[model samples]
Target: MTNFDKILEVAQKRQGQSQPLKLQDSTVLLEQIKNREQDTRPLNLKHIESLAESIAVLGLIEPLVLDNKARLLAGGHRLAAIQLLKEQQADKYLHHFPDNRIPIRMLPFDAESEPDLALQVEIAENEQRRDYTPNEVKAIAERLRTAGFIDVKGRPKKGQKPLMPALAVVIGKNLRTVQRYLEPNQNTEQEKSTTPVVLLKQASTKLKQWQKIEPKTPQEKALAKRLPELLNLIEDVLSNEK
Candidate 1:
């Protein structure tokens, strides 16, 4: 079994239950969690805000995991979101966290000595995730624009904060990539340029360039021998194109 599986098995043997503790009480626990130095993943502000919003509506679905000594082993983002909610004084949402307390599950592990296990658990918790596809990302960007959450320029309509950057953070994409996905005209133009005629011209130019180069390497010689066959296939494809 993997380190996480072993930890989970141990936690299960020990009842596998979570209990509530005052948020303030966790401060010392957080300080004691020594794995922070190994955690290189930066905390995303937009992601924290999104989490806070969900937590407000649905409450925290997953309880934070802790070690035997009450040191944090996972759920850093959830903890940050809870702290943000507290700072915002969101009374309605804070109702779930009665007396400023949140649920946490403790595993019977020695975090101080088992540093590798602690780091493994932390990595397993964070890395076992999925991301949105390019099409889904485009759809989400379009929906946000249509909803007026973002303007034509991909900035917030009224607020000073730029929506694109915030969105980039939330979606785990760079600003330029998000911007490109948001541009309908750019996407359409790219589609238009992929016609059979355009492809044929591009391929023919590349073939001529390859023919001029004298093949030196074995790989190059092999590829040069197949160029004539490749040209025939390209010609057939173009001829069949409507």
Candidate 2:
């Protein structure tokens, strides 16, 4: 079967149940959608700009998928492109977009529950992607484990469903291959050598967290103001370490 067929099969089998598609403000959805930790896919600025241009003319062909609270289950790149377009205030597209609301397919969810289907959908969507470097895979795996999708030993977390098996399905790899990528060795020579990529991921995570910080205190305000310089210094340190 073709790759699209495989993706459709995975989506149909793993998505549990579907809900009716609805319209939501892109701006509001942007605010509410929480990105998956495992979603470490790098954004392509050229691709995003090209997509925004196409969207301006052809309009959105596919709706975004989200959970109940507007947390993104998939379509990270698409959402990013739309946000970019909005930031530029693309007037030609605005007439077609209408209050900046885009179509969405909302998935079933419970915030307090264990291992919602949203994660399953995320893995499925992630599987359809390609061209990830070894470093990117390892970094994504680290984030997945840290988010409690998997345990310290790289097994699925307690009360959480099996991630490796599902990931294997999406990734089209054998369980062992998937395991090797998902489970990192603490003292491995390769890991020690790839420290810079790992440090880069941590730095990116810190910047994301900083975005959420309120900056109420004087120290916080100072840190906020100098965040760009801090990031530049961090980059220099990483380069020297490398």
- Number of the predicted model whose TM-score against the real structure is largest: 1
TM-score of each: 0.45, 0.38
The C-alpha local distance difference test score for the whole of candidate 1 amounts to 0.64
Q: What overall lDDT goes with each candidate model?
A: 0.64, 0.58
Give the alpha carbon lDDT tens digit for every residue of 86-189 in model 2: 77756855765776567776654532242445555566565655544445555644544554444335554557734454344333366677666644463375
For candidate 2, the per-residue lDDT at 52 reads: 60
The number of clashing residue pairs in each candidate reads: 0, 0
Global Cα RMSD, each model = 12.6, 21.7
Deviation of model 1 at 100, angstroms: 2.0
- Name the regions of candidate 2 deviating beyond 4 angstroms: 1-34, 37-40, 111-116, 126-242
Candidate number with greatest lDDT:
1
